[model samples]
Target: MVQQVQEVAQTGDNSGQDLVLSHVTKRFSDFVAVDDLSLTIPAGSFFALLGPSGCGKTTTLRMVAGLEQPSSGTISIGGRDVTSLPSHQREVNTVFQSYALFPHMSILDNVSFGLKRRRVRNPDAMAKEALEMVELGHLAARKPVQLSGGQQQRVALARALVNRPAVLLLDEPLGALDMKLRRQMQVELKAIQTDVGLTFIHVTHDQEEAMTMADTVAVMNKGRVEQMGDPRELYELPRTAFVANFLGKSNLMRGPITEDLGDAVAVDVSGVRVVLPKSRSAAHAGSAVVGVRPEKMRILDIDDAAYSPTANQLVGRVVDASFTGIITEYIVDVPGVGMVGTFSQNLGQRPAAPGERVRLLWEPEFSFGLPGDEEPAEGTDAV
Candidate 1:
């Protein structure tokens, strides 16, 4: 199946291409896999589509790759409409989770297969350069079965890259590797993409993988995009509770609006007041959900010590303490609300033991507000 890609002619256009999807959607029977999704991936930019399984991320990638046709809308590559084009005619290459290398062929032969079929001159020389790009030039004589998992994965990458397609689509390409090798490959993949200056559209369910490799990330939910931005922007100011919880660990507290100060609003969470800036939220005065990341919160020893009137503080009894190498995670039980988790670095103060009373301190600016009762689109919980 992989060798069939070699039969397609290599496009002469050498420039990188921007991918644009306008109101693209896919429907399977009565189920809509993707819904009115529009995105713009700039030329030479590394972008990631991230979500849990069955969130339409893979379906969206398939639409762009011409593997799956959209029920409605159009897809354009480099300002040329290619929605109706076949996969072989789209000038795009895909590297999937499976290496799919030819076990009977040598590494160099595997890399040159596509070029040879396209009638490119000096296929062996071009293939050697591609192998060198992946730091596997020395292993050209080895067969697929002779190489380790990482080396085989690199050979697969070399195969895809030898054609120099306008866009490179990666669908969880590191999912098959172990944790250590996967981390190593993530760095190498991003570095290679930078060196080649190609537009890379990667789809992955791992948040860390997307955050580490891509310059921009789009978090998908159900059939639509929930949030899209740089890793820092999305992590710091999640627009919705789902983004807050799914992207990373967050403590969500629901409360009624007590004070509206235009730029900021104070919410009363079970007799405790917390202020969040309005710019980080779309919710007005009423009920809202305030989110604070576990790392942003600090655990301070409190023994009948009154906190400052203006400070954001939550008094809780420590119920559990867990040491996770560089940091210690503490689960505290607040009075009205349930358990709230916080992480403290192991560099400084020792972790408080269970049953110890502590105060959670965090800046008001760290909190993000969102509508408490906002109903997400249909099937939003698929993640």
Candidate 2:
């Protein structure tokens, strides 16, 4: 089986090793690409560096792979300092977005090229075993042009894994595939990493890609990490406005804290009052920005009998509505507040059309608060 081949191929002394970057920084002629970033990637873990364009995610990955040296910092693998080591000396391999395989050579030869150069014994057998691990052994005799895009990508991955590096670096490896194929590759990549048990550090600008494949995600902004955690934690309880808006859609309202009720606090947005949990609030006093995801809000008729007296309510007129199969998306404009978005499930009940008055209601515990000074639009346009 393919799993057996992977298990045997990965039985090296440096199979699972921790990668550490201490005070890593990269500067290019006065522009700081990465500023004082530090991270600890555990052994045999899937970690992703996610951000928009020019956020220093790719630069950080280059530093780890020795393609670009950090201006000031140390990179260590398995507690050994490899900051000054060259690319060939370090036990690391990288798979780029472009499948840079040799067109003139067969798939087996392409994978065995590195081993052959190093004068390793039984290069053909080792390369064949690696190809089998990726379920491409049957196509070993075919050239790069003879395979599909997905198959070529698997070949590139097999080439990287054939070396049995201590760590694997993926630089937007699935960026070139089509949407449906990209989703398929995401699942395959995660399964391969799990079977091999190697430390994988992936860099990507796609939020969904990072969330779907990585066990932990670090969101970067302006050469610094805005937030880092598991996908669910970062989505449910964002610590900053950028994270709240970047990870997904959020309805943010700025207000002043009026009262602190031990476990919760009350804030006044315009003339309306809303309650936020103390544990979920980053700003305790002064001003704060309360945020709730669109899916957490319910758009109901103004005089609906299902309205709960204890729920936080806001009155607004539906500015726009779109029926998207399973859910109806609505944009409501409140008099004192800006436009707020909400998603209501379509369960046969008629949805509020445009120009209709409706009430937006949500539980207090579902809302999170960030510092008032943070820009609510920091990451709204990132996608």
Candidate 3:
């Protein structure tokens, strides 16, 4: 049996949010794309719809943009339902991943294209203002092919923001840029959003992008929203196995509760035991999974590891170690915990090398129950 839902009352100030998706679904023949999804995005907030390909993330965003018509349910912008509205009629603008800029048109002309179509009184003046907003005023006359990938992206952003819509939707806008440029654009995008005070709903399958730029993250799976919360909450207190495994690195331990209370439970996990803070039920108390983040695992030298607690100690042989500049990652093969990934604090140099034996420890508070999925066995202590 799954745990009962915890009741939390809603408040009024929540209604003034910019985007609302209520039981919104998109279907193609019989295949359901967006499945009765409901969500509220506040104004001036940067929100991300994150999932793997074909997980309905893009479909949900498209429904918001009025690009892909929903088969059922309603979508609203700034509080009014616009389920039947056309893309152009909604107070929303989108920047596609392809840049979608006219190749021959100059940067200024491309930005002005949307305003011109809407028959704005002074399209040139508005285009100049938009170009200046993106710091592209100096490059206004340059063609799309003439600008670098990062510059081109800025122009694309300028085009979308120029309309001054109520909400801006981005569909993998950074997917085209190289790693360095992508990193730069992430900061720039967040800065621009904060400055403009506009609601941004971004769609991406990239984990780092979702965490870094967006104020809140909504992780999706299968055609439904698996979890929705701030990035810190989603990563630290993942409620489901899919969320734990998908969002970040996790060591999942399978077992069942030996004792239970209303608010907490003691679980027997692979011969080890841990007391989880939150109460959970899984069918019977016979089986469940505990997810622990890699960073939560503390690394200790063999001597320092001697006194580790019975509930959390794990001895493992390091299969591989790689330095990633800021932090070093290691693949540790542990006996009861399996092969779990971990990281060490960067102190200017890497501490452990490949083939080293190490021990990692944490506590019961670090563990949480996940309903399904179990990994294979691994580990042998070899220095």
How many backbone clashes does every candidate have?
A: 0, 0, 1
What order do candidates take by lDDT, descending?
2, 1, 3
Best by lDDT: 2
For lDDT, candidate 1 versus 3, the one ahead is 1
Whole-model Cα lDDT of every candidate shown, in order: 0.86, 0.90, 0.78
Candidate 2 residue lDDT tens string, 323-363? 99999999999988889999999999988989999999999
List model 3 lDDT by residue over 1-383, tens digit each. Answer: 00100000011122244788898888999899989999989987999999888889999988888889998898887768899999989878899889999998999999999889989778887777777777889999999999998999989988887777778899999998999999999998998887777788999999899999999999987789988998988888777767777787777777766776557676776666666666433323656677778887777666663564656667788888878877788888877667878888888643766677877778767766766454312111120
lDDT of 3: 0.78
Q: What's the TM-score of each model vs. the native?
A: 0.92, 0.96, 0.86
Off by over 4 Å in 3: 1-17, 260-264, 279-287, 301-306, 346-357, 372-383
Candidate 1 C-alpha lDDT tens digits along 1-383: 12222322123554647899999999999999999999999988899999988789999999999999999999999999999999989878899898888889999999999889989898998788788878899999999999988888889888888887888899899999999999999999998887777788999999999999999999998889999999999999888777787788888888888898889899998889898889876676889888888998988888535565454689999999999899999999999977899999998665799999999989888998879784322223433
Candidate 3 collision pairs: 1-283
- Pitting candidate 1 against candidate 2, the one with the higher lDDT is 2
Candidate 3 residue-pair clash tally: 1
Error of 1 at 333 (Å): 1.6
lDDT of 1 at 215: 97
